[model samples]
Target chain A: MKKKKMIISSQTMELDVVRKVEALSGTSVRRCFQCGKCSAGCPMATFMEHPPNRIVRLLQLGQWQRILAGRSIWYCASCETCSTRCPNKVHLASIMDALRKLSWDAEGPSKESYVQLANRLFLENIRSYGRQYEMRLAAVFNVKSGQFLKDLMLGPKLISKGKLKMFHQKNRNMAEIEKIFSRIEEMRKKGEAL
Target chain B: MDKTLNYAYYPGCSLHASAGEYDLSTRELFNLLGVGLTEVPDWFCCGATPAHNVDELLSLSLCAKNLELAEQVDGDVAVACAACFSRLKFTQHTLLEDETKRRQVEKAIDAPARLDGKVKHLLEILARDIGLERLASAVSKPLSGVKVACYYGCLLTRPPDVPNLDCVEAPTIMERVVEAAGAETVPWSHRMECCGANFTLSRPGVVIQLSNAILDSAKSSGADCVVVACPLCHGNLDMRQKEIEGVYNAEYGLPVFYITQLLAVACGAGAEKSGLGALMVDPFPLLKVKNIL
Candidate 1:
């Protein structure tokens, strides 16, 4: 197995991430005691760079830079195990979500491969048509990720197996989908306006 | 006639496709049971796993559209697909539980869809609305001693609020439903384990391992067969059974059935009427052993 080398930078604070964290957390972030219970309970944290408890502490300590760059935010399964079990009821998932938005805004360390591809295909499909079409998303993701040549043989086999559908059912009102996206885009700009 | 509740039923992509049996059987059963499911007037995708993995707001907001439509009808929505039910349920759960974040999601989606009323899966409604006694009385054919392993995959039970129908670690709705159908529910591990859902495509090896664990666990528990409420779970366990067997160099020929299929049997509906044979793995032989046929 090959190990990939990377660099670590000194952490700093950014007000936007802090404000975002405070905005999402109903109770004060100060209530947390760094028990590591939340991270211990997270089912998906095994795949995370930093688990829920650490992310919360980062906010408590005002290490906003590291919080924004950690890839753990993207990998959370949103399972709510941590939130439901939290003693302080700090809503760790909600905090992670806000940090995720900050991470996307910062465009930090390379997004995990499958997570990035899946996100693009999913949003593009939703933006284009009102609903998801799995086959279409798989094709788009495969092509964009440059895996077309490797799985070239499996494509035809999948089609023959009836695993991949030939076409997708578009929503009856596509204009409505576009309008919804526009409204969301407008709101995103407004949120960023401040 | 109380027509108070209205919803946009986002049957996940598989509901109408390979899992059409689930799509059809659920529609029939729900109507018979008096739950009004007006297919969303205009619906979009739930973004499955990708949306949430890619962008939390994107997935939650996309799900909010379906919930928003339910709000337009001024009623709560119900989803049949396990993955769809879990995703939409999580969105509603997230919003209602956190006021500030909920506001952000509402803002992110640019729609103020009220997340009222429980987003129920078919099994929960049956177990709750159509009580076990009523279900038992309606059973024209008692499942008797048929051993069924009730498999609740990660989505339906985990993330607490998503299903919140029963214990996440040990869900009993499928067990209760199977009991109502006159079948014995077999207790086993891997009941809450992930079946690698959509990962069956991207990572078949992982899926094979997960599927094998489930099948082997059920077999060890003395289950003659397995029953599931989620079509995606059924597809993974049933369609991939052979692959799992091949990969493990073991024969685990357990038959998997949709809970509704077994209910149709208990209701005295013939297999033809219920489209039981349409499953990727035929369950007739198991039915024969139980004398259900």
Candidate 2:
């Protein structure tokens, strides 16, 4: 890869943004040389508005809004294909994760999409049951996302096969699970990244 | 090798719900093999896919709590679900590699993270712990002439270092296991392909597209059926095969079997005990044809 000739300027590099992404992901955006390996191996790249390579390029240029405005961040499935295939060892999956965390917080009420909605419902389910209660998660998600009847047809079949349980099962250490969440929330309130 | 080996089995949420068959088959297969698997007492979820993507600390902490529980058991944690395997291994990797994150997870779980070899997928136990030779000798009803496509899916071998079991891009552990049971595994390109597991619930179309491609690859390779270790992959490829055909406007009548189910069948256990009755894709006709039912 050849470096592009450009004059260096303080305004050209968003040092704080770069450092923040690095701190959270522990992967340097500067390590990416636009090799496109990450995007090349990404299965969901076609569905994404901006491919992972372009997102990394945007990150390198410190164009936070340009990267976040697109739905690409939400499209990542985090399969780790890119992370495994990267010769630069960039861990694009983790970077995508960091970006999603940032973008999710920045999302407005009207900005909710299916992936975002599912993610919120998923965490909420985990927070409550300590494990994914599939039927409950789906029903609550359907109610919240206003897709009440979505996947309704599949429920009875799943139930008949004993795949979906009617009653919720809680972990033995529900108090411990609750404490873990509270500890993380308490840390977040104190300005922690995670 | 010891006649009997023990493991702290950590069947994740799916085992109690959607993947009950997998849990049943795993226990049955292990029982016939003289392998003792003790379920970790009161084990919580391993934080699977969503937790890591949402909060790194919460993900690590969730996995750490399970690891702490497994530490009280006899052996390294043995998991059947690929997602739980990946998350738990990744948690151990993270807690070992980064001290600050380790401290954070330590604080969250109220337990010290033991990164010293406490997590392993069931495949590792079969292929490495219990030698393939032993498994082969134990097989009474060999699935001879049965052409199978061993699907590794994504999480079991990807990211190279997490589970760190087989070749990342092209895994062969599943093939070796099934092959030892006298089944012939066809060489296929989509072994480690992503089954769009995360999109199974939210976006059915994507799952259909990706899973169809995998099914197509397996079919073109002349596979009689498909074998999988991941519950979500099995769910997408088997439970939704009809919908997948509808979406792609093509037919792929592949019977997806959990590796343990097939292993149990090979080990002389009845199909019912292997949970074959619970499968969406009917394997009875095919198994009867092969005289392995």
Candidate 3:
């Protein structure tokens, strides 16, 4: 007798990641009857390849690969209309968020988008400083992403218009901020490895 | 007991820049109200529309860092800007819902703090905590008969729990505040409509269309002016009114104000002192016409 190997398709898995999403959001995912109301109410649903309702369905199946690989999850506006209107109160916005975390682990679509890259650098900068310094974030984002002069023209105009403040007003007890984020990051990595 | 409440405040990029008036007036008003809002020592962009448009988790982590810090404090974190409020609240909602995702966010953020639902907007604190009765008593000069259109915009109330200050759809915080200041808030359709927000840079035409809808709704409803709690709304409705007018071939210079500034004005804090002078489109004339000045 040959030994049997277990395989998981787009359908089967122990992927309770959806459960994690629902638990974290405090919304009842079990009650989602696939009414499509969440998708219908989202303002940015048209721009998404997978609408909020469908995304929730995908999460239920533990189709993590498709979700992490898909770009539609990134397009959610966090408008909360879907969650607001959901009869079952499935927080579609949060599930999309969970998928984004999966994407980070899989190193999926985040590579191509400079905006996403900028966001990482931006958060790291904030993690260090505890507040955002726009001028610095832009400069750092441009240098790292190799778009050194993307919005070069707007610098002087923004400064003159008093729109861009020069320096960050660093928060006191910044180490506390660093510590908090560090804890969350550690927890996230451990969860992903599981 | 003088429990000095403290929290990390994100002025959002716009509040520091285009809507400096909001930054100024909010801080001033908070100071007057005895709430200490220290800028989140060194915060990053909330990733508002940009990151959310590109990567979902990045946006969540971006907001989580701030939300995490807002939770670090005892009192609910107060955001002067509605965009920041919405993003922070949404991130809080997202993080608390999914345990694995929450762990992932915790990993991604890797900060030394923990969060527990303390994020909120200024309007919320004022209405729920401070109470409109107190806000009314603070009013020195009555803004009687000043017909105003209270614009809540999309970010403030849509998610319902994203630091919602009032009812999700037909929010009445602005109205209550206005009425507290002795002003009349007219009902209008485009109250919660998007003012193209940052999309104005990429999709000006869409914003122009939507802004026109908002302005037309207010104007048609006989509003003396539009009062908004968000800086972006003020930008589109007030500063960019000319662009909207050019597209539609009509005149619309409806005064848009930071709700706090209006509160200050109604409370007898002079317009200039309230940073009302900073508004790109002068609302003084409208105030004069409405006899509120």
Candidate 4:
């Protein structure tokens, strides 16, 4: 394996990009000392292309494009292990969250589209019914993501036990929820509806 | 009458669907305990794990709505799912601490940012408010000699400062509650571990591997069954137990129970009301052998 080093270079380091990540996450990136505690405790780090600490290091080096396009952000389940384990309180989970949003905005299409699809379906269920429609969330996510039959066998088994309700339980506060989504649109500073 | 205890119940998405067992057992157990639980009318989703992965404002807005709804009622809000409990309590902590973030969330939800109501997990209710002594006395069936591994999973007590529900590193709230039900909680390192939550769907392979680790620990620790406070953890550990066994080429006959389900049975609600039938990995065989079923 070839050796790689993190040498500080003014030409490669973009402080503004790091500042943007700090601002978006509302967490102090400056507090991280490369201690790797966040990466150590992360359960998803093994599956990630870049560990949480690596992403944080990239952010420190202003590699916004690299981090945004990476699968590390999409894989983070936001278990908060990294956030809680960090001695500096870096809140790596929040930074990973910011990166996920940025990935959707900048990267166009993600290989983790099934996950992205599910997130949208989750929100859409809430937007329409005032609460998450779990059955429909799966149906929509499967169909839209082209991952049909994902839980094909398990679905019937769960339904048989009455675990997955077929009928939707629409909350009476549907209009109120709609108003909130709309108001959020007006309040958004990111200028992106999604 | 004025002294009657009450709690506003917020059964999140899973409780209504996948984790109906958790909901059923919670209500059934609480009913047996004589604690009044009223549903938080028209409560919405807390966005769970996925929402935060997408957008911050979206995540905060969804949780804030439920918090606002809870404000309409009187006493503290009670929840069965750990994810919901964490989201509700975490949002409250974040909003109360950061004025700018609070304002943004309020603007996003179009609701005032005041979590006047206390959001608590069911374990907290059993451990703190009801007290272990009261819980122990209420147990009529006494899950006698049942070895339980009370899995807190990820959310129930992480991000130490935010929830502050118990000792973050070594939370025993679940264990304390299980002990009250006459079950011996096995000491294990995987109690506070992550079970790949929503990734159970997005990344099934990852879920299987991670869940196997938890199951391995529970088995090695001599636990007869695994218990959880989160529906996602239950789904991964219980629903995907077979897949985990197949992947790792091992058998984990351990039945995963919601903490509430264990309490429901111990309090004499019977297995019928405990939702034991809904479990993907059957706990009945073990329960029958132990005379708990």
Best by TM-score: 2
Regions more than 4 Å wrong, model 2:
A1-10, A108-112, A192-194, B1-4
Per-candidate TM-score, first chain only?
0.78, 0.89, 0.77, 0.87
| The best candidate in terms of lDDT | 2
Output the worst ten-in-a-row residue range by lDDT, candidate 4 chain B: B1-10
Give residue B145's error in model 1 in angstroms.
Answer: 2.5
Total colliding residue pairs, candidate 3: 41
- Could you tell me the C-alpha RMSD of candidate 2 in Å? 2.6
What's the best-to-worst order under TM-score?
Answer: 2, 4, 1, 3
Tens digit per residue, CA lDDT, model 3, B1-293: 21555545767766766678888887776666666777764465676755554345556776777666555446667787887778777677766665555666656766532557577787877787677887788787778878899998778887765565678877788788788888988988878766667544433454577788889999999988888888778877886687678889987778788888888887777776678776656788877876767
Per-candidate TM equals: 0.81, 0.96, 0.74, 0.95
Candidate 1: misplaced stretches above 4 Å? A1-75, A148-163, A192-194, B1-10, B31-37, B71-76, B97-112, B160-163, B201-206, B272-275
List where candidate 4 sits over 4 angstroms from the true fold.
Answer: A1-12, A107-109, A189-194
Tell me the tens digit of each residue's lDDT in model 3 across A133-194: 66776677677767766557656765765656787656666775666556555654666522
List, residue by residue over A101-185, the lDDT tens digit for candidate 2.
7776676232337777777777877778877888887787788778878878888988888888988778867888899999988
Error of 2 at B275 (Å): 0.9
Q: Across residues B1-293, which tens digit of lDDT does each residue of candidate 1 receive?
A: 23643444657667755676776777666554555676766767776766665356667777887777655444456677887887888787767776655666676666686677557777876787667887787788888889989888767776554568788766777888888878898778778766766655454555677678889999999998888878768878987887678778987778888887778778877786566766656688888888889
Better of 3 and 4 by DockQ: 4
**Model 2 interface DockQ:** 0.67
Worst 10 residues of 1 chain A by lDDT: A6-15
